[model samples]
Target chain A: MQRKLISGIIGILIALLIGALIMLVQGYNPIQTYAALFNFSLFGFYPLATTLRNSVPLILTGLSASVAFASGPVNLGQPGQLLIGALFATVGGLYLDLPAFLLIPVLILLSMLGGALWSGVAAMLRKWFNMDEFITTLMLNMIADFFTYWAISYPFFDRSAYSPMTPQINTNGWLPIWGEFNSNVIVMVLAFFVIYLVFNRLTAGYEWRITGHNSLFARLGGIKIDKNYVTVMLVTGALAGLAGGLVVMAGPHRFLKGLGANYAWDGVMIAVVANNGLIGTLLYGLFFSALQTGSLGMELITAVPREFIQVLQAVTVLVIVAGRGYLDILIDKTIARQKARERAT
Target chain B: MNIITGLINGMISGATPILLAALGGTFTFYAGVFNIAMEGMMLTGAFFAVLGSYYFDSWLMGIVCAIIGSLMMALIFILFAVTLKTDEFVTGIALNLFALGATTYMMRQIFNVKGAFSNPGIVPIPRIHIPLLAKIPILGNILSGQNLIIYITVLVVILSAFIIFKTRFGLRLRAAGYNAPSLDSSGVSSAKIRIWSLIICGVLCGLAGAFLSLGYVTLFSENMSAGRGWISLAAVILVNGNPWGIALISLLFGFTDGLGLLLQQYMPSQFTSMVPYVATLIALYFYSIQARKRKA
Candidate 1:
């Protein structure tokens, strides 16, 4: 636990340094960018509120990647599942008329189902045909994008409007916002605790951990590896789908083209940076949320362009990939030296 | 007659990019590294190609710029994957995201354009006339004529196959992928071989990107390769990284993409555009099932 925390801290420090270098290249002092980002998120009420609100969908997507990754299937199709889920959620919200109490849960359920069905294709391929889930999921993302684009362009399209977007949902389905923060934050928090319990405190999580660590060993011990693999993907997909519902019901209350906002990719990055474990994802979510919220202020204050944040984000990813191995080597060498000294003593 | 002509010309144009990218993927796969960065590299190549053409007013300069840019990205991939031993998949995702942001940034920075960079000054590669073959019917139109890159692609395919099957380096590449520890025991540096493989892969992917921008559209659009890198990855996996098989599978993918374009002309544009993706699902489903059966 101590080691993981230290490594995480080190990773953030390295990311900050690289970010500073990129800022320097863009003709802005790194100090100002950091100050703006820190001040806004810490003291500014609006920025803090926005960061919390933005984290809602990210939490779900992070969980989506985490669940499958824990079970050993790299669910790269979250982007597609989220898109389809949002589409279904929009249909449920726009077409159906019901009280808020009944409408919200029903739409959420439908969205989860839509996401599951989308992911189910890749899961089934992995189980029945031994096809690589990675390729299938990646390809399905494209298919889903096409489906969503077509939906907004023709059927769901508001003809009078130039942009490709569906009509707003019935007000009854709209989630209540707390001041500036959307009710989506509540949904995200609830999902996090539920997943935390299910993954950390349950026997299912143990099975998943063992299966991921050594599939053959778990199989020999009489575990149903295939079933577990498929089940996790379904759950993960469902959570991602629920995120779609959150978008429609809690925030936007409408389905727009490109509504997923590349969150699927963002979710994967969060999960990876988090190392697919509990607590780590939440922390990474907060970190990314800060970067995103802070970028707005950075853009407002400097002629440096807000995209310097993206350059920072990209550099963080690059450095993380490059630094992880070296970190591991560093730890190994330190351990080796300690052992040698102990032997000499 | 137009359908026949479309069939031939479409296949060549479609196949050219996939062939170049997949062949690059095969080299990396042979060295035990799944270079997922090909997508990003292709995007980088496309951007540089456009940037070069825009500035120099020459397609030749554009192609050169693309290859160099892609090679630079490949070097970064090697630093992480081969030198540092970081996970390939993670690096790939980073590269894809980085490519999107970097190219978009450059596009906006250089030309102040968003989403696409199109200028009248950019030169697109022109079709090369092959003596008697240019007058021939469907065969001539399809096989004998294309941009210079198309002919180059065919040559590259043949050479790649020859190199993989007949060369000592190919044997070492295979050895490293299949059994790295064994190569280590034999006093061979697995890292060096993998690095070389990635460089070669980089050059191939670079050419593929050039073909997309310089060979086909002449303009580089954001995310233009649009998951073709993944398609090529699928081709590599489905064909098991065999160069000849890579060529054949790429043509198969190219044909589907071509057929989709033709089908769209007569059908609803939405469904027509969906043809290639839907085809991928069906083909991948069979591929997976076959692999499972083999494992059982």
Candidate 2:
């Protein structure tokens, strides 16, 4: 655990160094850019709130990726699932005539259902037809993208709006806010708590870990790997769907084109960089969110493109993954040298 | 007759890039690597192709620059997945993200463009004028006046078949996939074989990218490769790296794509744009069923 943590830190430092180099090459001051980024996004009251708000979807998506990874299938359908979920939430908010308390829960549930249904298709394809979920989910993402675009463009488009977007949901469906914080942050926190408990304390989590580590071993241990796979996929889908739902209820209050943005991909990267651990995913998700929110400020102040953050994030993942092997070699060398010195003594 | 000719011509052009990338992916697939970074490589190639063409005023230089860019991406994949022994899937995902970011960043920095970059100075690949083929009625109309790369893709498909089946390197490549340790014990380094395959994959993807920016269109757009790289990946998976099977699948996909373009005159483009992806999913479903039956 200590070694892993050390390597992760080293990986991050290396990534930052590389980012600095790139900025320097582009005739910007990396130190000043980073300072302004953190100060603008993290130190201020409003900026911190915005960072937290942005992190809500990321936390959910990161957990979604974690759950799927823990169950053996690489579910790359988070974006599609998120969009479907948001679409369902929008439909429910628009058509359902109910009190605030009743309607909000319904919208959330509908969103989860939408996400689950979308991911279920990929799960079913894998289970029945022996299709690889990786490719199927990717294809499903493209389909969902165009399908949702068509849906809002023709069927649900807000005629008064200047851009492509669905009609705004009833205000009752909006997530409650206290000060600058959306109640969706509560949802994110609850999700992390539940996932943490399920992973660390539940027997089902044990089965999933076994399954992901080795299906043959899990089967020999009398676990139903197929059932676990389906259950985990559904759970992950719901989590991702909830993220989409929250994005609508908390911020946009409507389904906008390109609303999914890069959250799903960033979430996947977080899960990978965290080594698929729930706690690690939360921490990394928040860090990535800070960078994301901060990038805007940095861009404004330094005339640096915010896209540099993406390059930084990706390099960080690469370094973390690749640094592990080299770190192991170094550790082994240190131990060997210590043993030789002990013999001499 | 004219419509049919146009459809056939569009199909070939649509399939050329996918075919090129899949041909490259076939090598990596046979070498025991699941290279999902072809999309990124192709995107990088597309961006650099435009950049090179705009600066050098030559399409040939654009192709060279694209190959170099794609090779660099492939090198990153190899370094992590092969040398460092990390998960290839993770490495591929990271590389794809890197390519997207780097390309977008460079586009802004170099051209001050946000969504896309185009200029009159950019030279597109010229079409080949086969006078003899042009005089041959419907066949002539379908085959003549195509982009130069389309013809090269045909030659590449044949050449790939020969390389995979008839060469000693092909034998080692397959061996690397099936049993790398055994191949290692037999004195040939499977890692070396995998590296070479990825290099070849990179080159093919480069050509595929060049085709997209310079041949298929005259400019580069953000994420312009779209899902063709993924479609190429599906083709590779469906055919299990058979060059001819890949070509057949690419043609089918291209046909769907071309049909989608044609149908856009009658339907909303969003619906029309979905034709190829939906078709790919259906094809994959049926292909998996057939494979299952054969196994049984």
Candidate 3:
């Protein structure tokens, strides 16, 4: 465990070094750019708040990806699920004339259902047709993107709005705010807490781990692997859907084209970087969010483009994956040496 | 007649890039590598193709540069997924992300433009005019005057069919997918074969990218490869990486894509744009059912 953590940190340092090299090549001072990035992202009040806000969807999506990955299937359908969830939330917010207390919960539930239903199609396809979820989910993402665009542009078109977006959702459906921060942070926190408990304490978590490690073994152990597959997909889909709902409710308060953005993919990256650990996902999500938020500041201060942050994120993921293997070999050799010394003594 | 001819032309052009990428993907798929980085490879190729053409004013140089760029991406994938034993899917996703960022950053840095780059200096791949074929019939109208890459794609499809079925390397490639340990015991390095397959995949994807930028559009735009890589992947999966199957599926998808383009006149483009993906899902569904029946 210590070795793994050390390797992860080392990987991050190497990634940052690569970022520095790129900046240097571009004729910018890496030190100043990085300094401005951290200062604008975390050290200040407004910047920290913005980072936290940006992290909300990431946290939910990260947890979603974590749950899916920790089970058997690779759910690349997060973006599609998120979009469907947001569309459901938008539709509910616009049409449902309920009080804030009732309406918010309804929207959330609706969003989760929408997400579940979207992923459920992929899950069913896998179960009944023996289709690979990876391709189906990816195809679903494209379909969902265009489907939502058609939905908003045609049926839900707001005549008064200039862009392709649904009308602003009812104010009652909006997430409550505390100062600069929205209540969506609470949702993110609650999600992390629940996922942590599920993975560490629940029997279902053990079954999921077993299923992911080896489904044939899981079946032999009397675990319902097929049921677990569907359940896991639904749960992950709901988490991603909740993220979409939170994005709509917390800000914008309406369905917009390209609303899913890169949040779902970023979430998936965080899950991989964190090795699908709940706590690790949270930390990595926050770190990535900070980098994303800070990139703008870095750009303004140093004339460096914000897209460099994406390169940094990708490099970090690659280094962590590659570094872990080398780290394991080193750890194994050290263990062998210690055993030899103990035997001599 | 004019509309039909235009749609047929669109289908051939649309299918060419997808067929090229899928043909490349077939190598990696047969080598048992779940390489989903084709998108990144193609995108990187597209950018470099434009960059090389813009600088050298030669389409040949552009193709060479594209292959180099794409090979670099493949090298990264092999280093992590093959050599380091990291999860192939994770490495692929990261590479895609890296390609997007790197290409976008380079476009800004080198071209001083955002979103897209195009120039008169950037030479497009020339179209081949077969005058005799053009005078023959409707077939001539559909096939003649196409870009050089279109003809190259046809030759590749045929050559790939031959290589995958008749060659010793093809046997080893399939063996690597079926049973790597058995192949290793036979003194054939499965890892080496896998690496070679990926390298080949990279080269083909590079060609596909070059065709997209230089032949299809004559420019490099952000995400210009779009989801063609993913679509190519789907084609590979649906057909189980059979070269002929890839050709057929790509043509089917190309038909939908061309139909979508033609339908844009009568419908909202969002719905029209969805035709190919929707068709892919339906085809996959049917293919799965067929496979299951065969298993039974």
Candidate 4:
């Protein structure tokens, strides 16, 4: 934990350095711009609220990726899964006639099923035919885009609406919004504990770890590698789908195309940054959400582009990727220099 | 225009970038690294090529800029993946995001443009019509009048096949993927081979990117590679990382995309647009099933 914290701090500093350089190149005062962003995200309630809302999909997607990464498949298809979830959830909201409370939960669960089924496609391919899940999942993202595009542009497209999105769920089905943050944040918090329990208190967690570390070793140890891959993907896909569902039922209230745009990739980054820990992933998601929300103001107040946060986010991931190995190389260089000094003296 | 001719032309245009990117991807795959950064490198290449042509008014200079831009990205990948031994996926994915954001920011800052830019001053890559081939009527009509890069891709595919099968360097590169320890013990330095192959991949991807912006579209747009990088990776997987296989699969995917364009008049544009990607997934599934069958 100490090592991770130290690396995290180092990683943030490197990201900041890159962010500052970009600001400088763009002729903005880096310190002032960063201060403004932080001021909005940390002090103001509205910005913080926006941050919480923006993090909903990310937190879920981060959890999704954390599980997949732990179970040996690095799923890059979470966005597709999320979209599948959102698409179906919207369909359920429109067609299903149920009481508000029951219908909302059913829609959320259906979204989870949608995501799971989509990921199952990738997992099944991996299991039955010995395909690599990494590439398959990425390929599925594109396919999912088409699926959602078709759903919106043809079947679910709202005739009265100008954009390619489904009509809003009846107000009864909508999760009551709590100020700027949606009620889904509550469910997201609940999910954090549930995921922690699943990872720590279940035998399946052990199986997942073994498979992730080495399939050959896992099989020799009597773990069902194929089953574990399929299960993790299902759970991962469910979480991803629920994220999209939450956006529909609680936030956007519509099945908008491009729902969770880039959030799937962002989730992967958060998982890596958080080192795949459930609670850590949520914390990283919040941090990213704050940056994303605050960057909007930064663009208006300063000349910094909102997309610059994306650059910072990517740089942060890169620094974390360069973590322990990078420090070891640095220490080795230092030690070599000291030994050379001793020899000369 | 004949529907057949238009569909074939669209297919060639659509497939050219994937073909070049996959051919570029072949090197890194042989060297044991999944070059997921191909998308970003290609995107960077596209942006720099446009900038190159926009400023220099010369296609040659544009290509040069693209190569330099993509090579820098490749070197960054080498640093993280090879030198630091970082998680290749994280580095690759981050580099991709960085490239996307950086290019968009630069496009806004330098060009005073948002989303896309097309400057009339920029020169496109020339189209070549081989003299003898032009005389062959139907065949010439179908094959001729392609961007110079398309013909170059044909040569690159054949050359890569020969290099992979017959050359010492190619053998070592493959050994890096299949048996790195033995190659290392043989004093071949797998890291060195990995680095060099990635550099070559970068150059080829650079050319591919340039082709996308200059040859096909004559414009640079935000995320204009439009997941072609991922499609190219699928091509790599579909072929199980072989040069000739990459070529054939790329053409097949290209045709699928062209068919999507042609079928737009019949079906909903959204559904028709899915042809290439849906085909990619199916192709991967069938390829893996075939592998399993052969093994059994």
Candidate 5:
């Protein structure tokens, strides 16, 4: 835990350093830019509140990736799964005329089902053909992307709106807002606790951990590896679906083209950065959300593109993944040099 | 008669990028890295190819710039995945994210444009225009007036196949993946081969990117590669990294993409655009089933 924390700090430092250099190249004051970014988020309640609202999906998708990764399926299907959720949830909210209370829950459930349906393809492929879930999920993501793009442009095309988006859901289906924060926060928090319990308390969690560590051993120890694999995939997909559902309910209330662009990949990054730990994901998801919104503020103040923040985010992940090994070599070299100097003396 | 000609011609044009990328990835696959950075590298190549061509007024310069641009990205991939020994998948994802952002950012900075750009100053690749072949019937469409990159792609695949099967370096590359420890004991450095494989992979992917922007369309667009790199990787996975297999699979993928374009007039544009992606999934099903049969 200490090492992970230290590595994360180092990763952040390096990520910031890279961002600073880019800022310098672009002739912006890096320190001032970063300061503005923090001030926009921490000093103002609204930015953080809006960030919290935007972060609900990131948190859910991170949890989704964590669940599947814990069970050893790479499950890069979050992007596709989220879109499936959005598409189905949009369909349900638009076509189904239930009371507000019932419709909201039902649309959310439909979204989860949509995610599961898509990820189920990968799970089945893995089970039947021993196909790698990674490739299968990736292929499914493309299919989902094209399929959704087609849907939004065609049948769901909102003639009422000026863009290629579905017609907004009836106001009854909107997630309740609390001040600047959307009511998605309530479900997001509820989800965190539920996932925390599942990770810490459930026997299924133990099975998933074992299956991830060693499939042969897991099988030998009476763990139902195949079933566990599929279940975890479904769980993860459901989490992603929840994210999609919440995204639509949170704002816009429509399935617009490129609604969650780069959002799915952000979740994957968070899960990996957090090492798939529930607490880690929660904290990192919050921090990531803050950074995401902060960068937008920074862009407004410093005239740096938000894309620069993306560059920083990517660098952060790379450094976090590579930091341990690189740091070990650095420490080892230092120790060796000290010992050699003492011997020579 | 025209349909056959159209399909065949479409297949070549469609498959060109995928085949190039798959062939590039095949080298890295033999060297034991999943090399998921192809998508980013190809995108980088595509962007730089256009920039270079637009500035230098030469298609060849565009291809050169692409190779160099992708090589830089590949080096970054190797620095993390090979030298620092980071998780390959994580590094790949990072590379892709960086590529997407960097290209878009640079596009805005350099071209002062967003989304896509094309200028008359940029020269597209010249077609072969084989006069004798043009006189032939339906087959003429397939044989005549193809871009130089298509012929180069065919040659690269053949050469890659030869290098993988007939060369000592190929044997070492395979050993790097299959039995690295043994290869290490035998005085061959798997790391060197892996690095070179990535460099080669980057070059191939660069050509693929160049083909996309310069050969196929003389414009640079944000995310212009449009997941073709991933599609190429899919082809690579389906064929188990065999050059010939990847080539054939890519051709099929290209054909579907082409057919989708043709089918758009008949069907909804949305559904037509989705046809290739769905085709890839179905083709993967058959490929996986074939592998299952072989295993059984």
Candidate 6:
């Protein structure tokens, strides 16, 4: 907890310093900019809801990314799977004339299946051909994107419209809202707990860890490493797919092409910064959510361009990475010095 | 004749951006860094190129600005990934997100454009056709007429091949990627070599970015580079980190892209655009099988 807090403090300090530099360059008051960023996000009701709304898909995507990373395979296809999931969810909602209670779960389930099936291709390649999942998944992301664009722009395009999106999902299919908060928040909170249980305390988590640390060792110990790989990837894809469903059913009423909104990438960032831990991902998800929320308010209130927020995010990562770099140098130097001392002694 | 010209020109133009970006990725791979941020870097480069050209009214200035901008990014990446030993992939993704958001915000702030920008003064690279080459029928029209960047891309491809295969530095880079500790033991600073390779990569990606904005479109748009970075990465992987092979693979993708455009115009627009992505998958599958066979 202390380490996490210290890291959080360090991240904030670095962000503030960069914000100051940017303000100086752009001729804006740094303090005012920072105040605008926070005031609109935490204090304003609309902004707080928007932040939670933006974080809905991210929570799932972050969990998906963290789980995959924990399994030692980078699932770079979250964007692709999520897109497919959204499409599936939209279609399910549009065509199915079922009760709201029954329809929502079905849409979620089918979307998860769609995402899992899409990701299975990469998993199969890795297992059968020893293909690098990173490369395959990344490539598949574009393919998925192209597929969605084609679907919306051509066949499914609300041809009656100029927008690049499908018709809005049925009102019955829309996820219910509890006042300002979308009901999807319930799903997100529940998933966080589930992720904690599965990752932290479950036997499945131990199996995953064993396989992730060393496939050879896992295989030698009679664990079905290849099967684990396939299963784990499917689970990762399912979470991403669910994220897509959440976005569509809970937030956007229609299936907009590019709804991925780089969420797959954002989720990966959250997971990476969180270091593949469930709790860490949850915290970082909220932090990133806050950043996005604050940036929107900053844009509304001040001339501080949204790009500054991007620069701030980049600066945050850069500072973190550079800090790690110096730490690496220190460790290497220490190791070398220890070797020298051993020889001398 | 017009159709043939479009196909040929499209192949050359499309291949140029990917070839350069893949080469950039190749340099980082040699240095033992994945550099997935190429997409973001290319977008940043393209945005700066347009911004520079818009302000200075000079393509040369745009190209220079892009190179410098992307190189700065490369330097930051090297500082973090090499010195800090932070997860290379994480930093790459962060940089990409930074580029996307920053570029979009800049477009809104600076140009007052939401998604795309086009203006009269934003001149594209003037096309050039060889004198003797113009006499030839199909090949002349297809290959001869292109912007200045296409020629540079072809030249750089050959140059990169030569550098990778013939130079001692190339050998050291390859050695570093294969086994960094081994190179460290040999008194070669693996970090320095990696940093140099990344710098070279930055230059190539910058050129690629300039090609997209100044050479092809004459305008900058939000996320205009699209997934070209990932496609280039696919090209690099498909070629197995070989410079010559990478260029060839990029050309193959160029042809697929051309085919897609052609189909989009002539065939049903919907299914035609899917060709390039589908082709990528098929090519990747083939490449992976070949790789597996070789390993076996």
User: Scored by CA lDDT, what does every candidate get?
Assistant: 0.83, 0.91, 0.91, 0.86, 0.87, 0.82
lDDT per residue for candidate 5 within B189-265, as digits (tens), equals 99998999999999999999999999989999988877788888888888789998998898888888888988888
**Which candidate should be chosen as best, given TM-score against the real structure?**
2
User: Which pairs clash in the backbone of model 1?
Assistant: none
Give the per-residue Cα lDDT of candidate 6 at A120.
Answer: 95
Candidate scoring better on DockQ of 4 and 6: 4
- Best of the two (3, 4) by DockQ: 3
lDDT of 6 by residue, B95-147 (tens): 88888888887788789878898888775666778899878877777667779
Question: For candidate 2, lDDT tens digit of each residue in B139-254?
Answer: 88777889988888999999999998999999999999999999999999999999999999999999999999999999988889898899999999999899999999999999
Q: How should the candidates be ordered by DockQ, best one leading?
A: 2, 3, 5, 4, 1, 6
Pick by DockQ: which candidate is best? 2
Better of 4 and 5 by TM-score: 5
* All DockQ scores: 0.63, 0.81, 0.77, 0.69, 0.69, 0.59
What is the C-alpha lDDT profile of model 6 across A1-345, one tens digit per residue?
665556666876887797798788868888888899988777778778877877878879999998999887778889999988888888888888898889988998978987998899899988876777887787778778878887787767786778789888878888898778788888888877887788778988778888778878988998887788898899899999989988999877888866888677788877877767788788778777778779877888888876677667667756654564455577789999999999999
Residue-level lDDT tens digits of model 3 in A186-293? 877987787778867899988998898898999999999889999999989999999999999998999987899889999999999888888888888999999999
Model 4 segments more than 4 A misplaced: A328-345
Report the lDDT tens digits of candidate 4 across residue range A230-298: 899899999999888888888778888677688888998899878787777988899988888888888
- Determine the C-alpha RMSD for candidate 3 after optimal superposition of all C-alphas: 1.9
lDDT of 1: 0.83
Per-model chain A TM: 0.95, 0.95, 0.96, 0.92, 0.93, 0.91
lDDT of 1 by residue, B151-239 (tens): 88889999999888889988899999999999988999988999999999888888899999988887888889988898888888887
Q: After aligning candidate 5 to the native by TM-score, how far in Å is the CA of A109 from where it should be? A: 1.6
Tens digit of lDDT per residue, candidate 5, span A246-343?
A: 99988789999888688888899888888788877887788888888888788788877776777777888888878966777788899999999999
- For model 5 the local lDDT of residue A218 reads 97
Q: Give the winner by lDDT: 3 or 6.
A: 3
Better of 1 and 4 by TM-score: 1
For model 2 chain B, the run of ten residues with the poorest summed lDDT: B136-145
Pairs of residues at least 3 apart in sequence or in different chains that clash in candidate 6: A324-B84, A325-B83, A325-B84
Query: lDDT value for candidate 5?
Result: 0.87
